[model samples]
Target: MILETGVVVAVESDGLWVETIQKSACEVCVAEKGCGQKFLSKLAGKTVSIRVLRNKRSSEEFTVGQSVTIGIPEDIIVMASLLVYLLPIFTAIGGAWLFSDSDWQAVGGAFGGLLLGGLLVNLHSVRKRDDVRFNPVLMEEQIQPNILNFQH
Candidate 1:
């Protein structure tokens, strides 16, 4: 499981809306100062909002400001990435091979195959949008100093 820490922004009946900073590995690399990726990461916004499943037993105990860790399986991420990227590439190659006799025909076939592959991926994703395996779940809450304890 890959875990991430975020702050609960809102509490819903079925889940919590958590806001997390999106950090790239380059951010902490020793050579980050000279890496092009570091510059691109800066261009990308710092935060993202994700919905995490609320634990049924602790749902009522959660508050908006609470800090928590969310988790998703590593395999799910790998599978999603492959489906989005490799499918089109393989399909395009297959299409080109089918029309190999003519150069222009091969190019047109590859383009059509790429579009079809993308459409298939989109349809599959839409059908599985609510699959539990792809959803992130609340792992555990982090303890923070109670503001009520401070007296001024």
Candidate 2:
């Protein structure tokens, strides 16, 4: 399971809105000097708000501004990466192989397959948007410590 820390922003009937910053892993990665993830993450906008189900925590205790740790299964992340990255490449290769009789035909087929793959990805996303398996779960909550006042 992968964990992320976020702050509870609001309490709703169905879930709690937890807000998190878009932090890049490149900072601590050994390949930071050679990788483009840091640049891409910078271009990607910050401040993501996720709706965490209330099944794990109660509104009475999980108040706004309280820090919470959420977790997503590693398998989910791996599957998503494959679907997003490998699907299109495989589809294009298949199309090219199918139309290998002529160079022009193969090129056209590859482009068509890429488009089809992208459409499939979009359809899958729409269909699975509300899937509970894709949603992150609240693992732990942290309440801020109260400050002590000194006697005058």
Candidate 3:
């Protein structure tokens, strides 16, 4: 399981809104010889909030400003990454190769295949929208020191 610690910002009947501070090694890497990832990380936002679906089996919880752990299965993440990121790329290459008789045809085929891949992704998401396997599950209540994590 990939676990993340976040503070509950809001609570709803069916879910909780958790806020997390996004951090990366790039933000703290002071090595002068390092790449430009530090600059990129600075350009990106620092705080993110995500809604976590509540588990019915979970006991009644606390109020806002409380920290909690959320987790998702590693296999689900791997499969989702492949489907969301690689499917279009592979399909586009295949379409171009299959229509390689002419340059224009190949380009058109690639674009068409990309669109088809996107549609397939959309369909899959809709079909599995209600599946609990794809959603992040709320783990145990986390009570730790109130140490603020600011890497700015």
Which of the numbered candidates is closest to the native, going by highest TM-score? 3
Q: Candidate 3: where is the Cα deviation over 4 Å?
A: 9-13, 24-45, 57-65, 141-152
For candidate 3, write residues 1-152 as lDDT tens digits.
Answer: 87778887888876778887655344466773467555555677466797777777342454677677887688988899999999998888888988999999999889988988888999998887557788777875544433453225
* Rank list by lDDT: 1, 2, 3
User: Each model's TM-score?
Assistant: 0.68, 0.64, 0.69
Best by lDDT: 1
lDDT of 2 by residue, 50-142 (tens): 877654546776667777777778898899899999888888988888988999999998998898889888898878765768767777543
Inter-residue clash pairs, candidate 1: none
Which ten-residue region of model 3 has the weakest summed lDDT?
A: 142-151
Candidate 2 contains a number of clashing pairs equal to 0
Q: Which scores greater on TM-score, model 1 or model 3?
A: 3
Which has the better TM-score: candidate 2, or candidate 3?
3
Please estimate how well model 3 matches the true structure, expressed as its whole-model Cα lDDT: 0.74
Candidate 2 deviant stretches above 4 angstroms: 7-19, 32-67, 140-152
Query: lDDT: which is higher, 2 or 3?
Result: 2
- The CA lDDT of each predicted structure is 0.76, 0.76, 0.74
